[model samples]
Target: MTDLPAATAASSRPDGRASPGLRARLPFLIPLVVLAVVAAYFYVGLGRDPHVVPSVLINQPVPELALAPILGRDRGLTTADLKGEVSLLNVFGSWCVACRVEHPLLMAVAGQDLVPIHGVNWREPTPQAGPAWLARLGDPYTLVGADPDSRAAIALGVSGAPETFVIDRAGVIRYKHTGPITADDWERTLWPIIQKLRAE
Candidate 1:
C-alpha cells in the first residue's frame, strides 16, 4: 500500500482489472484484420474475366441425349444423331433472355448454312413455349429437342441457358461456351474452334 508498483499502477484500472488501453493484445483487432483481408480478396477477384466457365465435358464424348422434339419439329434429338458431322448444340430456353439476345446470331449461322446447329430446348415452362418462341423468332436449328426436366441439360453440364457446345464429327464435345454469343465471339473464338475441329 505504501508503494504501489509503478508498472502495475499505470496498467491497472481503478477496479484492479488490467487496463485494456495499456494491453497490446487487442481482442477487437482480430475481426478488423479479417474483414480487411476478405475485402482485398473480393476486390482482386472482381478484376478477373467472368466469361470463363470450365466444363468437364471438354474432350469427352457427348452425353446421352435422347429427347423429344419441340412442338412442330418432326424428329427428336438422339446421341446417334450427333455423330457423323461437326455441329453446334445450343442449350436454350424460352424463359431465357440471354438466349433471345443470342438468337439473331444463331439465325445468321443457320441462314448461312455454315454448319449443323442443333438445339436443346432446356427447362421450358411448357412444350409449346419453346416452339412458340422459336416460331416467333424464327427456328434456326437442324434438329430441335425439348428438355423440360433438365435431364439432358444436367448430363451436358449446362449451368444456364444459351450455353453452346462445339461437337466433333465423332460426337465428342470439344468446347463449351457459357454465355450469349456475340459476333466478336463467333469470329474470334467459336468459329476458329469449329474450323479446327472440322479439320480433325
Candidate 2:
C-alpha cells in the first residue's frame, strides 16, 4: 500500500509528549483560577468579625412606617416619631433568644435615659406575645411598635432580630448594629455613637 503522510506531533497523542495549545488548556485553567480566587475571598471574609455586616441604610432617612403600638397604652410609632431627637430603634422578636440575651443591656440603657429607645416588634408569632415578652422582660422601649407582617422591618433593612439602628434628629439612620448588643458592645461601640449623635 502507498505510504500515507506521517502524522504530525499536533495530531499524535499516543506518545503523550506534545504540549497542548494555550487555547485548548485555557478553559480548564480558567475555572481553577476562578475557584482559587473565590476561595481566597471567602478565606479573607471568614477572618472578619461576623457580627459586623455593613448597612447600606446608614446616612439615609429612616424608612417610613406607621406601626401599631405593641402595648395597649403606648402610642403607635412612626418614622416621624424618630425625629426631633436622637433615638435607638431596636428590631426584636419574642422568639429571638438573642433578643432576650440583650434585654438586660437594653433595660440598663433605657434606665439611664440617655436616649429614646424605640422598638420594632418584628415577626412575632402573635401581637400579644410582643407585649407580654416586653412586660416580662421589663419593657425597655419608649415606644414599642408591632411589625407583624415584617413590612416595617423590611423597609428598615432588618436582617434579623436584635439588630439596632441609631437615628438622628432628622430621622436619618446614623448607624446599624447587626447582632445582639452586649454590655461591652454598648459601652464600646453603641454608647459612643449614641453620645455623638445626641450631641449633633
Candidate 3:
C-alpha cells in the first residue's frame, strides 16, 4: 500500500497574520537608536573628558626666568637648571585646596624616582610655609622654587596652581595636567607620557 505524503504548513498566513515589510524592519532600528543615544550621552554630559588646553610653548624650548630662592636656600632657581634633565614642574600654593588634594599624588610620583620634581610656590602667603607644609607631609620636590610674585609662573604661562608640566631634557614643555590627579589619569595620561619621555 502507498503511504500518504505529509502536508507542510504555510510559511506565511494569507489573512495578513504576518507583519508588513516596514514592520519587520523595526527591530533592526533598535540598535541604531541605542547607539545614537550613547553617542549623545558622551558628547553632551560626560564629565570624564580629557583636558585639552592648547600649549603655546609645548615642544618648544622652555622660556628663561629666575625664580627666587626656595625654602630659604641662598642660591636661586633658573631656567638653565631645567635644561639638563627631565623634570616635573608643579605649581602650587599653601592656600590652594586643590594643591593640598594633589600632595599625596606628588608624593607617589616622588616614590617612583623616575624624575625630579620642582615645586613653584606661586603667590603664596610665605615661602617658609611651603617647606613647613612639606616637612609636615613629605617633600616630593628635589628643589623648590619660590615664585611668590608669580613672575616665573607668568613667564611659564601658568594660570593657576595645581598645574603640572613635564619638561624634557631639551627644556621643552611636553605634557601638562590641570586640577587634581585621578587614578585613571595616572594609568592613562600621566604614566604613558612619562614612559615615552623616559624612553626618549
Candidate 4:
C-alpha cells in the first residue's frame, strides 16, 4: 500500500503560556479587577474603630422630637427643651448591655452638672421597664423620652443603644458617639466636645 503523507503534528505552546483565545478575552476581566479593588478597600476599612459610625446628622439641625414621658416620669423630653443650652441626647434601652456598661459614666457626668443628660428610651419591651431600670441603676438623665416605637430614634439616625449626641445651644447636632461611652472616652473625647459646644 502507498504510504500516506506523514500526519501533521499538533503544535503545543510552552507551559504557563496562555492560549490565544484566553488572551483575546482579557478585556472582559476589567470589571473583575475593579470589583477586587473595591472589595479590598472595604476589607481594609473593616479593621478601623468599631465604635466610629460616621454620622450624617453632624453639624445639622436636630430632628424634631416630641416624645411622651417615660413611665413614672412627670415630664417627657423634646428638641425644644434642648435648644437653650448644650446638652447630651443619649439613646438607651433597658435591654442593652452596653447601656448598662455606660450607665455609671453617665451618672458621673450628670453629677458634675456640666450638661443636662437627656434620654431617648429606645425599643424597651415595656415603657415602664425604662423607668424601673433607671430606678434600680440610679437615674442619670435630666429628662427621659420614651421611644417605644423607635420612630424618634430613627429620626436621630441611631444605629443601636448607648449612642450619644452632643447638641449645641441652637439645637444643632454637633457630634455623635456610637457604642458605650467609657470613662476614658468621656474624659478625653465627649467632655471636650461638650465644653467646646457650650463655648460656641
Backbone clash count, each prediction separately? 0, 0, 0, 0
C-alpha lDDT of candidate 2 relative to the true structure: 0.86
Per-candidate Cα lDDT values, in order, are: 0.91, 0.86, 0.78, 0.88
Better of 1 and 3 by TM-score: 1
lDDT of 3 by residue, 111-175 (tens): 98867888787887876787777788887887777888878888877776688888888888998
Provide the global lDDT of candidate 3 against the true structure: 0.78
lDDT of 3 at 40: 93
Number of backbone clashes in candidate 3: 0
Pairs of residues at least 3 apart in sequence or in different chains that clash in candidate 3: none
Q: What is the TM-score of each candidate against the true structure?
A: 0.77, 0.77, 0.71, 0.77
Task: Output candidate 3 Cα RMSD.
Answer: 6.5
The lDDT, on a scale of 0 to 1, for candidate 4 is 0.88
- Which candidate has the top score in lDDT? 1
lDDT of 1 at 14: 62
The TM-score that candidate 3 achieves is 0.71
Q: What shift in Å separates residue 154 of candidate 3 from its native position after superposition?
A: 1.2
